[model samples]
Target: MDRVDRIRERKREHLELALTEASQSRRASGWDDVALVPSALPERSLGDIDLSAELVGHRLRAPLLIVGMTGGHPDARMINKVLGAVAEAHGIAVGVGSQRAALEVPELAPTFASVRDHARTVPVLANIGALQLIAQGERPALGAEKVARLVDMVRADAIAVHLNVVQELLQPEGDRVTGPLLPALAALVRVAPVPVIVKETGAGIDRESARRLVDAGAAALDVGGVGGTSFARIETERAGVGEGPFADWGIPAAASVLECRGLGVPVIATGGIADGATAAKPLALGASLVGIGRAALLAANDGVEAAILTVGRLIDELRTAVLLSGGARPSDLMARPPVLTGATEAWARQRGLLA
Candidate 1:
């Protein structure tokens, strides 16, 4: 393999290992502070709860979304294939890992493309890094003319512009990050033909920034919040490195969803979402959908069927949550009365949002 490909594989391995071990760590989303109060009165049946959700004009069969995991490397292709097959089986949306590798290495395109190949029914979003595109320099100034071409290559339903500064700063072989990022995003949103989604890798986007992103034409937002897969911590374990107390540095998935609500853009909750209850929390916090990454990877390792089954269980839980709350659909879960106390409550109240 070439030097870049080899380096990519190494990083992928590190991410896989770190995520597998994350649950054992002290880090938690502090969800203990937010409780979804149980209903005592008459309620609907779980089987009737509609998991359908609308995102970027497409309707997803389930409220659970498969967050972007590995790609670009050879091993990642197989994983993506497994993930895509399952996503299609369940009729849920999926996101491909950072497509920077495809933009660089031509041979890598098919692996990422396998998503559309395997999952024709679900929406497949292509992912790219803001920093990487910016490093391309004159590309955006030229109207990102080639950007749509790249997205089309994989039949991406939408394009995810992921903000991964923490991961970048963590890796020794990482790229540079300069500030004043809004203009470039605005350009991508205007230039790219498909809908543009602004996403965080782990650190969630806050209210003020979400408002600006919406103004700049972000069709949707993925709050890849903290409490799951601390990319900073992942890098630290990989290189025995630290970004000086930046390990737990991000907004939890629950809080980020609440913080960025009503920005004129659809919001997705990500990070620290492993099971059905965790996945449902984001929906309760006003997220259009909930995303799970690390859990899928862990499930994939056991085999594709197992991975899909794991996701299916989470979906079942989401439906149950909606029914128990006397709601008929996944969106209704967002409006349920969830009692909040402690840190999660404080996080919500700090932003003047506790619903």
Candidate 2:
């Protein structure tokens, strides 16, 4: 296969394996250790709750984002269409997978661009890897001009620059060079017409990294923490290797959320969020939005209605969780602090995030 064909094959493999149980991390996301205090007299009813939230200057009916997961292959076109339709129907946000593949082969542009056709109103984020900001092998860095095509192709409301160092290290054909990424990111932020969101790819973001990203002009941060679909494991599997020590590595989702919170910009808690109750934890912990990855992907695979139903159920459960916690909105959960236990609490203590 040629280089473009190899990239397409890789993208197809990722889509197939991501939905399997083997791609999931065995470690806990720290949500299980968190318990919200129930109220005896929650005066507000579920019907009165408001799920609306704002991110990157766009208002959304719900604070849920269908995290970028697929693109660059023929099959990915329909998946993007389904996900985009679901997002538009629910008034939530959606993001496409890395547009690097399309940039290499213009023919695949339709696969990623399909999102804009259905998700006309909601915020659509265009994705690219941090490695693409620097030159690798014979390929030159994707400078300001090429990056603009990424946004134009998706009609993106924002750009999500994903940081996937671990995945790159494991993948056979991954970009191995570690150049001056911060400066490139800063330059991209200066030139891009839309907000630039720096996101992790399962390893999660720490307080120090979050600070630097914010300093580099990252409009938001997606703490794609551990305890979810682990790309490390996926790469290993693709390489014919079994799960290694790094399979369950990185900061858990809950702790990462605490670490990323208090920063001025909005934080998106991603990792292993599976249900509405689980999603509510991050929102209460100061995350402006929650991201659904494998679950949404699986639902979309079943078709548009399934995707909508799955998202609708999760949103309903989120509203219910907030109501039971004596809150009229999702943000109210922050005031009623959760009682943390297990490894999650230990992490918070060591990180000095817990007082």
> Which digits, one per residue and each the tens of the lDDT, describe model 1 over residues 238-285?
776543588788787667777898766788888877778766666776
Candidate number achieving the greatest TM-score relative to the actual structure: 2
Candidate 2: tens digits of C-alpha lDDT, residues 131-190: 999899898988888989999999999999999999998888888997789988998899
Which window of ten consecutive residues has the lowest lDDT sum in model 1? 134-143
Error of 2 at 235 (Å): 0.3
Clashes (N, CA, C under 3 Å) per candidate? 0, 0
Give the TM-score of each candidate. 0.92, 0.98
Task: Give the lowest summed-lDDT range of ten residues in model 2.
Answer: 240-249
Report, for every candidate in turn, its global Cα lDDT versus the true structure: 0.76, 0.92
Find the candidate with the highest lDDT and give its number: 2
